[model samples]
Target chain A: MTTDTYQAVQASNINKRSTRWAEFLIQSGLGLCALVSIITTIAIIIILGKEGFSFFQHVSPAEFFLGTRWVPLLEPQSFGVLPLVWGTLLVTFGAAVIAIPIGLASAIYLSEYASDRVRSIVKPILELLAGIPTVVYGFFALTFITPLLKGIFPDIQVFNALSGAIVVGIMVLPMIATLSDNALSAVPQTLRQGAYALGATSYEVTTQVVVPAGLSGVMASFLLAISRAIGETMAVTLAAGATPNISLTFFESIQTMTAYIVQISLGDAPAGGIAYQTLFVVAGLLFVITLILNVLSQKILMRYQEVYD
Target chain B: MSTPNKPAFQLDYGDLKRRHRKAKIFANFCATITWMGVALLAVLLAQVSIDGFKWLDWQFISSFPSRFPAKAGIASALVGTLWLISLIAIISIPIGVATALYLEEFNSKNRLNRLIELNISNLAGVPSIVYGIIGLAVFVRQLGLERSLLSGALTMSLLILPIIIIASREAIKTVPMSIRHAAFALGATRWQTTWAHVLPAASPGILTGVILALSRAIGETAPLIMIGGLTYVAFFPEGPMDSFTALPIQIFNWVARPQQEFHELAAGAIIVLLAVLLLMNAAAIVIRHKAEKKFK
Candidate 1:
């Protein structure tokens, strides 16, 4: 071969190597971007573990888990986290009670009964509800819902569990409605027609054919919505008063786990103090419960998706 | 028509009637619930508007918070939100989009990819306050960013990254695979194809997602509170390192107070917040509508 041709061939080989190198660089760069999320997850766990473990050094597991009356910032400070957990559950249960039937009904109406125009309008309105800030909901709870509740029950506290539950329920409603609608709609149209042909009424078709077919999705939505209610902070904090009560009374002031986090956060708890440490412990518990619910919901959702798709 | 006589089987009129009635009642029940939901939304809007309409004046818009409710305004809160949002947008968009690109276009479902996907989902499920906790520990204390706008923005960016990545991935997926094939059939490289063809095609959908994510960040007070961004800042954020207060934080503080006037101020701030949210949502919806229309 000529020397010039040989040099040209070498240059082409060099060019191809550079191109491969460039591709590698680009892909790794994007991969690094994806790594940021993993890094975030690791960071969350480490921080929660690092600071959260210190809270345990002061308060025993039995006291933190089994004990009642959480008064971490008082004269005789107690570290029992059960009151906060109970309050969280009380609000979550109340919110679930408010959200489930109504949200499911709306889902049924939208997916099975409503006209397309109605669906279009109602869906956006529901999205509007979802888009409204939790802070705004907190404001609404304090200013509107509590006063409204107080009218009927004259002895209700200014910050009670009922208004918090109602608002949180409202917050989670759209999730249930939308998710269940998707689940119900994913059931084949032919199944509905078959049910109709078999002398099933629309109600029968919806309850038996549609809902059963989409049971997992509906379940997942419920789980996820409830999980959301568990994590809801501002609304619960504002509506439910900071007095950590062990009882499940809707009329009384109560503090939730989330509310306690905010309470400690808003206070002048020094970072290394037991008061601040309690914040992490409570947050760690909140994280675990929510993570479990979330994982279960996703598992259910994945199963449903696999079945449908 | 003459063959429609009851020849095959006997029809139970009473049972059919009962069933029809039950169906009608159930349908009506669901309808009532839906209408009630719509009505509740209307009531919420009306209540806020009524309470805040008189309070929302020029003075309320331009001043800062005060011990006296009459002197408190949304100016600092508004500026802080702007700074936070702008910073969050800048920090999150590139990382989110790049991650989405990696997941959607650049890789197969390898172990690392699977881990990333799982991590993102779990992160998405993590509560906002938990993100705030992480922010406080990692950003505020560890990195010594303190209670600054940058810390708040970074915290929120982490909180919303999963959302942005998921949405962006969905958008990128909608860009037809054939587009990639066509680019590769030519001399274009993978990066070139994604950058030139795929990104533009997916830009509108990506934009809608970005706007919605940003709107979510706007209203979040929990994580910001955790990171100490809920301070009673009287001045606007001058830089990324400045301590700031967001609209929701301000509204939260006011609503937390016992005074009636502060509650009214909270109501007014809610109005501003809702208006901003509505605008961002409208922009997102319009973009989506236009994109859908282009296909039709």
Candidate 2:
């Protein structure tokens, strides 16, 4: 070969090597990005676990779980987490009572009754509702919902679980409606037709056939919505009073696990003190609660998901 | 016609009529409940708008927080929000998109890949405040970033990273496999094919996801509150290391005060926050529509 051809071959070899190097670099870069999420999960678990373990060193597990008081700042610093847990459950239950019926009904209507135009309009509106900040909902709860409730029942306090529950219910409504609507719509058209052919009324068909067939999806939506309600912070912090009372009454003031965390964080709790450690302990409990709920919901969603060709 | 006769069993026409009527009423009731939800949304928007418009002026946007409610503005919070969002976008988008690409294109169905997928889904559901604790322990304390804008942004990026990855994966999945085949047939490497063809095709959908995630990040107060976002910053943050306040935190502070005037200011700040969220959502919707049309 001539010298010019030999030089060209060498340049071609160099080009191939550079391309291979670029490919390797890009692949590894992408792999590292994927690893970031795993690293984050590990970091969260380690940090929370380490701090929470330290907290257990100071307080016994039984007292933290079974005690009814949560005054970590005052003298005699009782660390009964039951009050906060009860409060969280009360608000969550209230939210569920308010949200479930309306959300399910909305999902039913959207899936079965709505025209295409109506679905397009109403669906986006629900998305808009979901996008509204929880802080705004908190404001609305304080200014609108609480006063409205007070008008109906004069015994209601200015800051009560009912108002917080109602507002949170509203916040979680979109999630339930959207998810359940997808579930409902996912049922095969042939199933609905089969019911109709058997002289089933539209309502009968929906309630008896469609909903049962899509039960897992609807249940998954409910679980996800419940999880959302449990994890919600700002709305509850504002509307539910900061006093950690273990009351079951809807009209009473209560402090949820999230609200307690917020109160301590905003306050002048010295770092590494009991007051600060309680933050992690309660947060750990909150994390466990939500994580279990989320994992359970994911399991239901995956296991019972109906497939159609 | 004469051959028509009643069946062996009675039809019970009255019972049938009653059942039909009940069904009709129940259907109407469901529709009414759905509309009630829409009405609630309208009432919420109206109340906030009415309370907030008076305070939403150029002066309010330009000035800083003051002891007097009437004079107070969201300038610092707004700037802080902008800074935090920009930093989050800078940090999260590339990582999220790359992770999405790896999951969709590089990885095959395996135990590790399935675990990664499960991890991402679980991360998406983790409470935002839990993310704050992580930020506090790791970024703020361990890394010594303090309660600064950088720390807050890093925390938020983690919170929303899962959401972005999920959305990006969805977008990537929409790109047909034939496109990949064509690229391969043309002697393109996997990375080159994904980078040049697949990404361009999926860009609009990915853009939608980014905007939606940013909208979520902007309204987040809990994690930021956990990371010690200042509620009373009077001046804009000069750098990522400086302390800052965000729109939601400022609103939360103002609303918590007992004064009615501060509540009004809170409403005003909410309007500003809502407007930003609305704009971002609208952009996402528009882009999604365009993407749908192009792909179709």
Q: What are the per-residue Cα lDDT tens digits for candidate 1 across A1-309?
A: 566865665464445878779888999999999999988878777877877788788878888888886778778888888889889989999999999999999999999999999999999999889989899888889888999999999999888988889999998999999989998988889878887887888888888778888888999999999999999999999999898898757889899999988888887578788887887888889899999999999898876553643
**Which parts of model 1 are misplaced by more than 4 Å?**
A1-15, A304-309, B1-14
Candidate 1, B73-105: lDDT as tens digits: 999999999999999999999999999999999
Candidate 2's iRMSD: 4.4
Q: Clashing residue pairs, candidate 2?
A: none
C-alpha lDDT of residue A231 in model 2: 91
i-RMS, every candidate? 4.4, 4.4
Docking class of 2: acceptable
- Give the per-residue Cα lDDT of candidate 2 at A7: 64
Q: What lDDT tens digits, residue by residue, belong to model 2 across residues B128-243?
A: 88888788878988899999999999999999999999999999999999999976755677887899999999999899999999999999999999885578898879999999
lDDT digits (tens) for residues A1-309 of candidate 2: 566865665565445878789888988899899999999989878877888899989899999988888888999889999999998999999899989989999999999998999899999999999988888899999989998999999999889999989999999999999999999999999988877777778878888788887888999989989998999999999999898998869999999999888888887477788887888888888888988999999889889877765
Per-candidate DockQ versus the true complex?
Answer: 0.50, 0.46
Number of backbone-clashing residue pairs for each candidate, in the order shown: 0, 0
